[model samples]
Structures are given as C-alpha cells and as structure tokens.
Target: MRAITLSEYGGPDDLEPAEFPEPKVAPGEVLVRVRAAGVNPVDWKIAEGLLDALLEVRFPLVPGWDVAGVVEQVGLDVEEFSVGDEVMGYIRKDTVQLGAYAERVAASVRLLARRPAALSWEQAAGLPLAGLTAYQSLERVGVAAGETVLVHAAAGGVGSLGVQLAVARGARVIGTASERNHGFLRELGAEPVAYGDGLAERVRELAPEGVDAALDFVGGGVVDLSQELLRRRDRVASIADPEAVAKGGHYVWVRPDSVDLTVLADLADAGRLDVPVDRVLPLADAAEAWRYSRTGRARGKVVLTVD
Candidate 1:
C-alpha cells in the first residue's frame, strides 16, 4: 500500500510517498479501500507536531482521519456491515498512525457509517470531521427551532455545515465571514455578517433581541464576542478555543460516533445538509493540499481523491 508518510514532524514538505504493508484487520474493525480522504487543518497541525502533548504518534505516521471508501473485509464480531459496503467515517484512533491517507485502512465499526447516497465519494469524505465538529458544537449549545444562532467563519468547512445543520433544526443562522463569502452564507440559510472590529455590532443588528446561541469556529478572542452578543453565556461554544470553558461556555472536541455520522448522512440524503468540495487533489499531492489549507481561504472542504 502506498501512503503519505513522515518519519518526523515538521512541514508539509516533510510528507513523502512511501509503501507499507497492508494493516492487519482487528476484531470489530473493517478494512476500507480508500476512495477519497478529507484534508483538514488538524491534519496539517498534527503533521507540524502541535498535538504531540495530547496524541501519541509513532514514526512513519500515515496522517488523515476522514475517509469515504468501500469495505473489502470485515473483522470478527462486526455485524452492522459486511464486504462491499460503501462507508465513511472519522477514523481517529487513540494514537495517530496508519490512517486514511493510504490505499487502505482499518477502522472500527464504532466510527463507521454508510455513506450518504446523495453525496459523491469526495463530498462524503469531506463530511465526517467538519460535519461532526459543527454538529457536536451546535448540539452542546442546544441550538433549537426559532432561535437565532451565530456562527463564526460561517463559510468555512465546519462553520458552513454548522449553519446548514442549525437551519435544518429550524434555527435562524447568522454567520460571520469576509465580504466575498456573505453570499455563500446566505445560500446556506444564514444571514451574513462581515467579521472585523464591529462583528458583535453586526450580529446585534441582525438579531436585535440577541442571538440565542453562538458557535465560534474562529479563535481570535471570538468567544468574548459571542458572549457580548448572545442572550446567555451558557449558550455559547467553541471548537477553536479552550478559554470558552473558562468563560462559562462549552469547549467542543468532535467525537467519533457512528450514530452522529448516520444522522448527518440522513440529513444529506434528505437534502437538509451538503458538503462542498473546494478542491480535490490526488493522494500523492497531500503536501500541496496542506499548503492550500494553510492559506486559510478555502470556502468549503479540501479532499484527496485516492486513485
């Protein structure tokens, strides 16, 4: 199997194409033939060694978590799926290595869900990580129908999905982005606000009474801004800021849950959710994918087509 591997963590340039033996299937796990993989900021961050303190990494690491693929074999005790099942998952393990970047990967059934029929492999690959982050964060803040929810970086991967999911729950969405992305947010059923010095003021203008909840995907002191514009401090959450907990708001780290991914797939199949693939690069170009994500300008998801 060919994969993007690194013996040491540093920059995207450190990623190189290499061959490794096929991973052995374990009990309760399934081997997936990789068709597409999602590239996320965390992928690059892990490559740069930012998560060394939290996630133990072995050398010659294969870095990626989001995958949409076909099951070639199933380990013992797995009953939910079998060979030939088209599946997708957030395949994050306790330690980081032998991941979705390869031609094949062994993923636990606990993290696997059938891919949504409405989405292409690339789109399905893009949904797991970002979609789960947005879904879990909004759920933590308890976004409900008729409420006005504020989303920071509304047009980015996670934020855009958050807007759609909130809207699906009947919440009105107010999203922050650049002037260029305002129209994009509107398409996702959100009222757009340009993020800057007056971000709080702009959100206030949209929901004069105050936003019912806020999800901060951007971490540059935006939790404070969410507090100022939210009706209550408890109705705020942040995936990008741990300081949110200190400020009486929830700090969200997306969990790998088959149930949650199934719900997202249902939403997509029902036309209530969608993932935009901003760009699709071949698996060998993983380094370039990291560079593009580093620019912080992709309006949607970046995917690696494993051909």
Candidate 2:
C-alpha cells in the first residue's frame, strides 16, 4: 500500500509518500480499497501534535479519518457488508496510525455505512466527519421543525452540512459567514449573516424574538453569542468550544455511529442533503490539500482522490 506518512509531529512539510504494508483485517472490521479521502483540519492538527495529550499517536503515522471506498475483504463476524460493497465512514480508531490516506484501510463495521448513490466518491468521502459532526450537534440541541436555528461558520465544511440538515428538518436556518459566502449559505437554505461584528444583533434582526436553537461550529466565543440569541440558554451546542458546557450549553465531540451515518446517507439519497466539495487533489498531493485547508478559504470540503 502507498500512504502519506509523518515521521514525527510536524506540519505539511513533514508528510512523505512512501510504501507501507497492507493492514491486517481485525474481527468485526472490513478492508476498504480507498477511492477518496476527505481533508479535514483535525488531520493536520493531529499531524502538528495538537492532540498529543488526548490521542496515542505512533511514528510513521497515516493521518486521515474520512474515507469513501469499496470493501475488498470482510473480517470475522462481519455480516453488514461484503466484498464489492461501496461504503463511506469516519474510520477513527483508538490509535492514530494506518488511516484512510492510503491505498486501503481496515475499519470496524461500527464506523462504516453504505455510500449514498447520489454522491460521488469525493463527496461521499467529505460527508462522514463533517456531516456526522453537524448531525450530532443538531441532535444534541434537539432541533425541531418550524424552529429557527443559528449555525456559525455556515459556509465551512461542517457548517454547510449543518445548514442543509437543519433545513431538511424543516427548521429555519440562520447561518454566519463572510459576505462572500452569504450567497452560498442562501443556497443551502440558510438566511446568511456576516460574522465578526454585531453577529448577535444581525441574527436578532432576522429573528426578533430569539432563535430556538444554535450550533457553533466556528468557536471564537460564538457560544456566548448563541446563548444571547437562544430562547433557552441551554439550546446551543458547540463543536469548537469546550467552554460551552460551562456556559450552560453543550459541547459536542463527534462520534462514529453507523446509524447516524446511514441517516445522513438516506438524507442525501432523498435529495434533502448535499455535500459541497471545494477541492479535489490526488492522493500524492495530500500535503497540498492540507495547505489549502489551513488557509481557511475553502467554501466546503477538500478531498484527496486515489487512483
């Protein structure tokens, strides 16, 4: 297998393309022949040792979690999928090595779901992590139909999906982004609000009474802003801010669940959800993808395609 590896904790420059042995399939896992891998900030953050205290990372690490591919082999006791099944998953394991940025990866069935036929491999790869984050966050806050929900960073990967999913639930969505991305947010069924100054006021302008729920994806004190506009202070969830819990709001850490992933897949198949892909680079260009992700300019998801 060919993979992008990091000899130690560093930046994009540390990533190197090298040959590695194929991973052995464990019981309850399946080996996926990688078609595409989604580029996420956490991939690079993990590369830079940002999650050092939290995760156990080994040397010569492969740093990707989001994958869309075909199942090549099934491990013992696996009955959900078989060879040739198309699947997408957030394949984060307890350890940080042998990931989706390779020719193939072995992931637990618990993390895998049948890929939505409506999405291309690139789009499918982009959905698992960001979609799950948005879905789980919205779920945590209990967003319901006819409610007005505010989503921070609405044009970014997770936020864009958040807007669409909220809209699918029949919730009126108010999303925060730059002026350049306001139109994009509108396409996702959100009333767009420019972030950074008087954000709360702008949201209030749209919903005079106050929003029913809020999702903070950008995390620079947006939880406080959300709390101010939320009818109930606790009806807010933050993926970027851990302080949300202290502020009487919820802080969400996305977990891999086959059921949740399948719901997202169903939404896509029903034409209620769409994955917005900003860029697609070859697997060998993983470093370049990380650079683009670091710039924070991508409108949606960035993906690496494997031939």
Candidate 3:
C-alpha cells in the first residue's frame, strides 16, 4: 500500500507517498479497499507538528481522516457488514495513530457506515468527519425548529453541513462566507453573509430581532461578535479556539459518534443534507491538497481519490 507519511513534522515538502505494509484487521474491524479519502485541517495539523503532544504517533504515520471504500474482509466479530459492503467512516478519530491515507485500511465496524446510493464516492468520503462535526456542534448549541441560527464560515467543510442540517431541523439559517459563495450557501438553504469587518452588524441588519443561536467555525475573537448577535450565552458554540470558547462562550470539540453519523447519512439520503466536494485529486498529490486546505477557503471538503 502507498500512503503519505512523514517521519518528522514540518511543511508540505515533508509529505511523500511511500509503500507501507497492509494493515491487519482486528476483531470487530473490517479491512476496506480505499476509494476516496477526505483531507481535513486536522490531517495537516498533525503533519505540521501542532498535535505532537496530544496525539501519540509512531514513526511515518498516515494523514487521512475520512475514507469511503469497499470492505475487503471482515473480522470475526463484525456482523453488521460483509466482505463486499461499501462503507465510509471517520477513521482518524477512531484509531490512535493509524488513518485512512493508503490503498487499504482497517476500520472499526462501529465507526463504519454504509454509503448512500444517491452519493458518489467523493461525496460520501466528505461526509463522516465534517458532517459529524457540524451535527454535534449544532446539537451542542441546542438548535431547535423555528429558531434562527448563524453559522460562521458557512462555505467551509463543517460550516456547509451546519447550514444544511440547521435548515433541515427547521431553523432559519444564516451563514457567513465570502461574496463568491453567497449563492452556494443560498443553494444550501441559507441566507449568506460575507465575513468581514462588522459581520455581526451585517447579520443583525439581516435579522433585527437577533439570532437565536450562533456556531463559530472560524476562531479568533469571533465570540465577541457571536455573543452580540445572540441573546443567550448558552446558545453560542465554537468548534475552534477552545481558549476563547470558555472565556467567550461554550466550547465544542469534534468527537466521533456512530449514531450521529448514521443520522447524518439518513439526512443526506433523504435529500435534506448536502455533501459538496471541492476537488478530488490523486493520493500522491496530498501535498497540494494540504496546501490548499491550509488556506481555509475551500467551498467544501477536499478529497483524495485512491486506487
């Protein structure tokens, strides 16, 4: 199997495709033939040494978090799926160091979910990590039907789904993106706002009564604006900027939940959710993907097509 690995954490130049031994499946796990893998900021964060203290990694660790693939073999205890099942999952937050960057990967059965018939492999691969993050973040904010929710970075990976999921839940959704993605956000059923100086004022202008809930995907003192936009402090949540999250408002850390992913997939299959793929590149072009992801401007998830 070939994968992007780095013995030392650094820039994109450190990333290289190298042959590695195929992973063995443990009990209650399944070996999947990788088809497409999602590239996330977390992947590049690990490669750049930001998560060195938190994540225990062996030498030359793989850097993918989301994968959509076909099950090649199933472990003895894996009863939910067979050898031929098509699956997708958030593989990074599942295992300690191993991830889904290679031609094949062994994933826990509990974390795996069947891909929706209506979605392509690229679209399915984008769902697990970002989808779960958005769902859980909205949950944390107590987004209820008939409420108004403002999502920062609405054109982003998690923000894009946050918009759709909020809309599906009957919330009047307002999303913040660049001017270019305003139409894209509108297509996802959100009233879009361009992020800039006085962004909160702009949202307030759009809704004079104020927003009921606010989810900040983009960090850096945005909570001050979020707090101003929403009346209740408890109704605010931030996925990034944990330090500011506690001081400014509620903190949300992205965690893996199989049930949540299943519900999200159901929403997707029901046409209530949108899984947008920004671009799909070969696995070896991970360096370029990492560079683009670092900009934090991708319309949705960027995926790597695997052989």
Model 3 lDDT per residue over 1-307, tens place: 8877877777788887888888889999999999999999988887777887788766677878799999999998789899889989988643345678889999888788999877899999999999988888888888999999999999999999999999999999999999999999989999998899889789989899999999889987777788887878668888886765556568876776678888988888898887998988999898899899999879999999997
Model 1 Cα lDDT, one tens digit per residue, 1-307? 9999998987899999999889999999999999999999999898888999989988889999999999999999999899999999999999898889999999999999999999999999999999999999988988899999999999999999999999999999999999999888889899998899888777778788998999999899999988988789889999999888989999999999999999999999999999977999999999999999999999999999988
What digit string (tens of lDDT, one per residue) describes model 2 on residues 170-220?
A: 999999899999899988999998998888888888999999999999888
Error of 2 at 87 (Å): 0.4
- What RMSD does each model have against the real structure? 0.6, 0.6, 1.3
User: With candidate 3 superimposed using the best TM-score fit, by how many Å does residue 230's alpha carbon deviate from the native?
Assistant: 0.9
Most accurate candidate by lDDT: 2
Q: Which of the predicted structures, 1 or 3, would earn the higher lDDT when compared with the native?
A: 1
Q: How many backbone clashes does candidate 2 have?
A: 0
Off by over 4 Å in 2: none
TM-score, candidate number 1: 0.99
Cα-lDDT of candidate 3: 0.87
Model 3 regions lying over 4 Å from their true place = 93-96
TM-score of each: 0.99, 0.99, 0.97
| Residue pairs whose backbone atoms clash in candidate 3 | none
